[model samples]
Target: MHLYAGKKHQKYILNDCPNDQLLFAMGIRNGLTVSIVTKQPIGGPIIIRIKNREIAIDKALACHITAKAVT
Candidate 1:
């Protein structure tokens, strides 16, 4: 996952994403210029925009939740 911050005018390219479902779930829209790329088998990169400040995330404490509507 890659994080970017700007005046909501910045664009991001997400390479090798798992699926389009994740991107939609993250509240991303086409106008936002958020690109999500997924591999054929699954698993890839996801990029999202955050505020123009510092954010801290702990990978060890993170978890994944599957939605019935996403598959």
Candidate 2:
């Protein structure tokens, strides 16, 4: 499922990402635990948390990232 499908504050693990280098720079990678911090309104960026750092990424990019909920 896309990253956008995850609920805020719920942990997820990235399964696929189109831009590896870009997400790597932001500290996101396969197998890492992440969570949605906040999603901005109307075409704004989506805030995500990885390891203790929070990063904001545009919705377009976010839609390409696939994640699975962490049980």
Candidate 3:
């Protein structure tokens, strides 16, 4: 499922993406715990928290990401 579709404060398990290097540099990886922090208005970046770090990713890149919600 798309990471952008995730709601704020909900935890999710991150999945692999085509852009491994980029995501890795930002400390994101498969099986990592992540959560949506905030989404900018007017088509801007979406802020997400991975571990204790929060990173902002664009919508275009977010669409390519796959995340499974954690109950």
lDDT tens digits, residue span 1-71, model 3: 98888899999887756565887787677788888999999989889987788899988888788989999
Return the lDDT, model 2, position 23. Answer: 77
TM-score-best of 1 and 3: 3
Per-residue alpha-carbon lDDT of candidate 1 for residues 1-71, written as tens digits (9 for 90 to 100) = 33321112344442333334644565433323342222112232222333332222222211121111111
Q: CA lDDT of each candidate?
A: 0.29, 0.85, 0.85
1 or 2, greater by TM-score: 2
Model 3, global lDDT: 0.85
Q: RMSD of candidate 1 to the true fold?
A: 12.3
Q: How do all the candidates rank in terms of TM-score, highest first? A: 3, 2, 1
Q: TM-scores, in order shown?
A: 0.25, 0.89, 0.89
Show how many residue pairs clash in every candidate, following the order shown.
4, 0, 0
- Write candidate 2's Cα lDDT for 13-61 as tens digits: 9888886688778777778788899999998888998878889987998
